[model samples]
Target chain A: MKEYQKSKINRIKRGQNRATYDVEKIDAILDAGFIGFVNYIFEGKPISIPMGYGRKGNKIYLHGSQANRMLTSLLKAKEISMTVMHLDGLVLARSGLHHSVNYRSATLFGTLKNLEDDLAKEEGLKCFMDHMMPGRWDGIRSMHQEELDRTLVAEMTIETASAKIRDVGVNDEPEDYNLDVWAGIVPLKQIAEYPVSDDQLKSGIKIPDHVMRYYEEYKY
Target chain B: MKEYQKSKINRIKRGQNRATYDVEKIDAILDAGFIGFVNYIFEGKPISIPMGYGRKGNKIYLHGSQANRMLTSLLKAKEISMTVMHLDGLVLARSGLHHSVNYRSATLFGTLKNLEDDLAKEEGLKCFMDHMMPGRWDGIRSMHQEELDRTLVAEMTIETASAKIRDVGVNDEPEDYNLDVWAGIVPLKQIAEYPVSDDQLKSGIKIPDHVMRYYEEYKY
Candidate 1:
């Protein structure tokens, strides 16, 4: 589908001007970040926890220890909601009411299922690792069978999603724009610095190409 | 109290070794970021929305338009849960099972109250703005009465909270340390670029000291 069918569940009500349901746009926002805030009901109250995720087509993969409270709770509920946001810049407006941040955020609503099959579990784990840093999965040692058995992998089939993007500069009251106040945007970015090699690395083992590639792509 | 009293509600189950209920540590995590992922129940499902917030003592302030659905719903629920997380670095391990990210995250559970008084509302708004950038509230034009009237401010008195911090280097299995794989951390940072003046700024108005100071503090 080109756009998610907007139901009451996934629709964006506030700041509708910044909302979008385009499938590609929402996917772009999701692909831009690996960590998402996943929410589940706990003790009759909703709580969000940051978790790493991987997306393949409409399915998002999440894995944790078998006893992970949040993941197990989400599984029991059989549904999930995840939000990923990237703060791009701070919009310094001429007026207090107009001050805002430039950001791209997407919220996903989906149903979840467990990846119980061993091969499927491996694939899910690989996707999760690669999503954090592409090709890092191949560079790392394969997970031992015991480690895989202790992990719980959940797959979320995204049913609906919406994104809100605010990329513009200062937005102020037209009259206030003429005031003697300075206004602008302070662009923000998440960057990577040089990698620190592990102290116990095997002798003569250089940093892998995949790790260097990730650093090159994100380094300032 | 120096620490939040932990109950089943705020207890850390999975990563107990990394969890903290110390009030000061949690406050530091909250102060380091202006945006929080706030969760609320809608249609029996939990959904998280990213919102800007300010912290004062044990109180957190959130503001949005009067018609903001999330704020209105949070007010009606009379309780709230918000999570703030700052990603510190990528921990690349020699094994996929050991891969993790260094981060500091706090989750707060609180009761919400609307700031009905004009002065309280103004204070809440000021806290929100200053949290984004220190002294930003004074740098901008004051809010008009009409603007204030259209805003909804909610104060959350935090009753309990928990934080998890992971700032250490890669931890690989003892046996894996001898493997021919490189493992380490890639430091990550969110930085500010030089400010760009708004196109419609009033003539001869230079960038304010507060704004320049923020840029200087966060710039690469």
Candidate 2:
């Protein structure tokens, strides 16, 4: 397994036992979620904004309007960090101190560069859409040149990444286990509901295979 | 409606139409989730970490181990920012440009201070637990003095916050709307499954009302 070299900045100090530097493990966590919180320093204050992203190998692609504040600030700063997390379950323990949540989270740090060329920017946008819903770009209306002109695309090369995962049941104090209190995991998940077709959709236009597949797999 | 005064830092630029400074709306968004992405600067690189929080009026409370890195750093920095987002649905459109997600998100900026006294810390911890699962603090075992001492609780005074919400359906371009393409909203929600009691739980002790209520309300 390939591991990201641990540095002073990326090391996990408190929960070292739950942390992993394995590249594949980190990437798997990233792929499971399309939304990531992108951090940027604004007026000397750090702020995070949730943004849609696509990952192709070590490069993460992000796009926003040309005047997007966070994207431009990140471009100026050169380096950026993004975090993705999925809450799996709620761990309710007999004791307050032992209450926890099962989750898989990944944090990535790297340098970001704007994709100025038309082809690169187009590809980046395609990746962004396809990553959100696989095979979504194939049948969509092609982008006009003016639309592409007003979009800013960026690519970040992952320099170092770390993933932390907790999937076990409740871990309570040994003595508290026998107490007359319930302890367990309340599994949580994000599921899709029935699709509501657009009111103006042309009659008889059926949902495509990719769209149906996403709904079927995610539906509760 | 009371509104957070618009400022250069808190204003939304890109999706200005969906932005609101209404205090009640922002608080509603905050109350829907207990975990927030907290931004902190480490070695000059801005990074985000998911932290559990509780809100009371204008003050937000957070707790972690006494040696928690993020909490200590935020206390030292004096000011901090955090964001919470709930994805409502996927807006599939005829064109990629019009694809988006229906969501309610809030970003809060404030100054954090460590709660030094035992009473304040205890209240903060209680708020944190109750916020995650309502009525959860009462039935659980009380915290011991040593446990309380080993925990670090911080209270942030929310100075300004902003929220953006999008709950509409597909928004394809006017020209593209008539195309023979499917478009719609695939609703998404986070839900809880049936509770799984701990293996070592003393048998015959039924799940309490609080747990049952939580599961009933959240189960998909």
Q: How would you class the docking of model 2?
A: high
Residue B5, model 2, lDDT = 89
List-wise, what DockQ does each model earn? 0.89, 0.87
Fraction of native contacts (fnat) of each candidate: 0.94, 0.90
Candidate 2: fnat, from 0 to 1?
Answer: 0.90
Predicted candidate 2 versus true structure: per-residue lDDT over B120-165, tens digit per residue: 9999988888888899899898998999999999999999999999
lDDT of 1 by residue, A72-137 (tens): 888988989999999999999888888899999999999999999999999998888888899998
* Superposition error at B182 for model 2 (Å): 1.0
After TM-score superposition, what is the CA distance of residue B165 in candidate 2 from its true location, in Å? Answer: 0.5
- Per-residue alpha-carbon lDDT of candidate 1 for residues B110-143, written as tens digits (9 for 90 to 100): 9999999999999999988888899989887788
lDDT for A42 (candidate 1): 83
Q: What local distance difference test score does each model get?
A: 0.91, 0.91
